[model samples]
Target: MTPQFGHFRAESGAGPLRAPMARWMIALVVLLFFSAPALARTAPDSFAELAERLLPSVVNISTTQTAEGQSGIEVPVVPPGSPFEDFFKEFFERNQPRQRQRRATSLGSGFVIDARGYVITNNHVIQDADEISVILQDESRIEAKVIGRDPKTDIAVLKVEPSDKLKPVRFGDSDVARVGDWVVAIGNPFGFGGSVTAGIISARGRDINAGPYDDFLQTDAAINRGNSGGPIFNLQGEVIGIATAIFSPSGGSIGIGFAIPANSARPVIEQLIKHGAVRRGWLGVRIQSVTDEIADTLGLKGVSGALVASVIDNGPAKKADIRAGDVILEFDGKPIDQMRKLPRIVAETEVGKAVDVKVWRGNKPVTVKVTVAALEETEEVAAATTRAPNETPKASIPGVGLAVAALNDRLRSDYGLDEDAKGLVVTGIDAGGPAAEQGIKPGDLIVEVSQEPVTTPDQMAAKVTAARESGKKSILLLIEGDAGLRFVALRLAAN
Candidate 1:
């Protein structure tokens, strides 16, 4: 009996099928032999060479702070003749004088950026430390002094006089670093120095809400607590980022880590070294993100750019005639891709330099020249200013389903509004109306409609009608509330 051949296999004890089976096996072996090399090229053969060269430049940072201890806990109140009162008082007396000053120490990692002993680390690492020290790869301890620190970027520069010249690493362009590029990080994790980890760039342009300029590069590298301020290097052994934070629930490496890109940190580091502080340019305007609703209301093609909520008085933007309701599309020729990018770009710009700002106004692009100003140390305070009384009469705006009243003495008293409050106070709203659907409550005061001041209910109604007649599907309203001012878009009711 002869055994039959089935899909690349043959029955046992069938000598006739041996020749075909052998040929199939040979073909499979040949395919694997040719494809193995291609598969092997996906990952690096070894990170040892890169790690060895970069380890010397990495240093361990140790800080010591003298913290004052509490004397004792306060005794709880007890009823008269309570038996536990005596015991509690005795416990407090025994522990009162035992409190004393103690030294607290922390460990982190950093890298040498210059041969002259200038090092870069996180600002939080050595903050408020009474004594700071750096431990080198050769196990030599050197005292370091804080050169400058920027809390905004969480970067700090340190200076140390070493016995021998130090090895330094140069920065690489992080902008060119793509996702999935191989990266290496050398740091002291949990006080264990000279540890190295390798991974790929997991993501870029991540906003972790750590700071204002939060363009962080996310990596799956095993970054731990003591890795803060350490350098994240590319395959070329160039510093591309500084390890700043990590996202973990167990207080250990879950592989998600964040680093400040070299491009964003380099300028701040340079400014710190030269001026001992970072000088950020100021474009004094309050900005919010443009949502789909706002885009449709403003007749924009897409949801992009930063919507100017309010312009600071006498600021660079106000002086340049940048008003509220303007959508800033570009600054200094760079497109404002999102609301957050504008702040970072403006801060990096040179103070006192004139730059062209393109804004979307009246459904068209308008270019305005604004001389950037130095940001003041103090933040702008929104002081309540009294508005002059207007005798405008009240009216009902049924198109948007709003019943508003003028800001008069009687209305202010009824609404419990401050005497300084001005605008058309919303007294009633229909449940199914667009205004009510957008969270416009009965107490909200409509200060501006389509960026024009509306003191009376009639003015607000007229503005809404005009916006609808002009083919706008919705209108932008600046509403004032107990919290602050905010912009809202209310859709127009169909005729």
Candidate 2:
């Protein structure tokens, strides 16, 4: 129906306007029903109230470093009394002194975590600084000393003696912060101290290859060079993230910034304060992501958890009898939804505490109690071993795209294999075949077929035949190469 609302505002002829006004009200009500929810969120009218109070807690950090002198260019000895002799001598004398010593400075951001003078910032900010200075909002400059640093996560803590009571900010639960929630970032972007910018959490659980433990919270805030180590605060004026890096092509804010989540950073910060260094919990195993093909081949219900590539010798996993091919489904009662989640969970676990580890082994679930141990800075995974060979293959197996040979003394010497290395080494690969497509080389060792250890070519063939018979269409293999051991899934095809 065509409703005419022009007569609704006709005050002089109220009797005629009454019906139209009622119809206009009805149309408005109808339009509201098909619109956004009544409680839809909107931009806060202003962030000034939150910014004003948080400014004091955020700090500006300046670091000074004296770089080593550059090598002095050889000043040719000009002929005595030559016209160029004096100019050459003076130039050489002037540049030599300046080149011998130089001072460099850098600026970044941090926040007060404790009113007793404990501050938090990025390790790269004060990494090589000979002197660190923390600048407050009131223009007061104080010297800061490094308390501890963890390069893996790029987090650092500093201590300063403040003359008065310092304003400190508390941490909020970062795990609860969603992608669309509004956030405020206060930092010293490009040396502009006490600067505040607002944006929403762009993403979370981002792995930008910055470090091993890279569960960074992505944001679109104006994070630049000096914004490193600043706090990403939620609307409640609590710290939820610590700004660390940006993904800008032109070295300016293109809205892509990354921050260390408060939930991850808080524990490390506390450990750094309690001890001079971080003592991470170590679960000795080399793990890789569980692929869908691998899950299907191993009869797993779903593609999840970390697939153990190799178990370290005499370590926590070894002591608990966790095998090399087991898929760790849970650790300390927390479900490992992804492979990367295990490292962080294990690191946060208490040292020497016994925890239940659930793994997928033998096509079923197996639980073992493992005692956590302190992580050594120089920890290395020991070599994986295979059983003794039974018989060598006479020819290439046409169903599989790779040919395996039993390890021999001559072959071991040719490939520089250790004395105890016992496995079916890949002797040949057909061109354009499954193994070749997967980048398997000739010297690589086949350690396991699916989850069982393969000693001879016949054993490897039997496992492949069983997988094909079971309608898996592919087989999982544990290959040991120069880089280390890894699991590879190959489709069933002719060599």
Candidate 3:
């Protein structure tokens, strides 16, 4: 059948035209296969629609600070006959004013967090602002009144009286936001109104040393100078973070931006909205991380807890028998991952709630119940009793060559120390001794050695000898000064 069709079709003149038409049909099919998806992928969709939808809630914040000159500006006393007198007179006389007023103005971005004219922004945005004003996208200006400010977390709330209900944004749970989720940032970057940039959540839990409660969500959005107080929104248009900072060498955004997580800000913002301030729970204890050496000295196999340096007398921890040197492993059933985490957890706990505290003491874990106390601005309480008053002084040891003295009333006054600073003061330092080489100087107090309290030079010396006998090359010392206490590691010398 195929042989008969070839012989019959070639007999007609239409065969030649059909061959050229077949080549054109093949080329059309190949072009359509490649160019269809390419045209679909490169089409431009303007972000103006999204900007128009979000610009109503975005705002610009402007702050003003009046700086003053120092008092008593004096002209230089130059001899009348001196050659440089005329030059000095010409230079200084022009600016001879005793005082000058300087003014500072800054701009940042923020968003409406409520419809009743309540707003949220970074505390630093309007911090120290003599006057604060918010500029809306519609060119409406409104004076903002500060409701509250939390410097610890760098958050602030403000209120404005608008003629009508303003658009407000709801917060999204930052904890549920996954990495790589699309995010959009609406801010006034470089004084431009309602600038929008789209990117993904680059990372989370960035510290960045911005504040004490620094749990930031890192994003690649275009955050900049004026973006400081803006809102970073998720794809669903919920505020997940407040744009607060950026990392760039040229003082601009280079796609590395940080925002305070909504999870950490939600409670603070709610409290500020309701009570005009944040009321955190406080556990009055100075804590430090337990190092490997500290764990070994305390007869533990590893370091994984916070060491209680001192519990405030009559405070929550002290009332609960949480003693110094105890390792706090868990608090309120939440495991304390690090020393810094403990402060945040304790502060976030509800005040007056009895919480279970798991601590390690003497190679054992003990769970104690502690009632959380309200964290006040001025929490002045009696210091813990570390030693008995006027106890018999122990004789100083001579072998290790550390000169020590008992804690006395005169010594305490001389050292400018608190009455409760229970330790032997190092009075002298050997010229080339290991302690001196380790920067231990006279008048410095030795509080602890190898996790044991040292009240005299003999105790310190004995502890060092014991540690060395156990094949340890370094000794940990809890050193204290007029300011406070710190831990130090010193290399021990072989006798």
TM-scores of all models?
Answer: 0.82, 0.85, 0.73
Model 3 reaches what TM-score against the true structure? Answer: 0.73
Candidate closer to the true structure by lDDT (higher is better), 2 or 3: 2
lDDT measured at residue 470 in model 2 versus the true structure, 0 to 100: 74
Task: Give the per-residue lDDT of model 3 (tens digit) for 350-369.
Answer: 88999999998888899999
- Select the stronger candidate by TM-score from 1 and 2: 2
Model 2 lDDT tens row, 257-346? 999999999999999999968899999999999988788877898889999998889999999999888999999999998999999899
**Every candidate's lDDT:** 0.89, 0.89, 0.80
Better of 2 and 3 by TM-score: 2
429: Cα error in model 1, Å: 4.4
Ranking of all predicted structures according to TM-score, beginning with the best and ending with the worst = 2, 1, 3
User: Per-residue CA lDDT of candidate 1, range 1-495, in tens?
Assistant: 433334344443358768666677767766887788856536679999999899999999999999999766667899978999898898878866766799999999999999999999999999999999999999999999999999989999999999999999999999999888889999999999999999989999999999989999999989999999999999899999999999999999998999999999999999999999999999999888888889988778888899998788999999999988999999999999888999999999999999999999998999999999998777656554343343334466967877788777776766667888878888777888988888887667998888788887767877887888898878889988655677888888975
As a TM-score, model 2 comes out at 0.85
Clashing pairs in 3: none
Deviation (Å) of 454 in candidate 1: 1.5
RMSD of each: 10.1, 8.2, 12.3
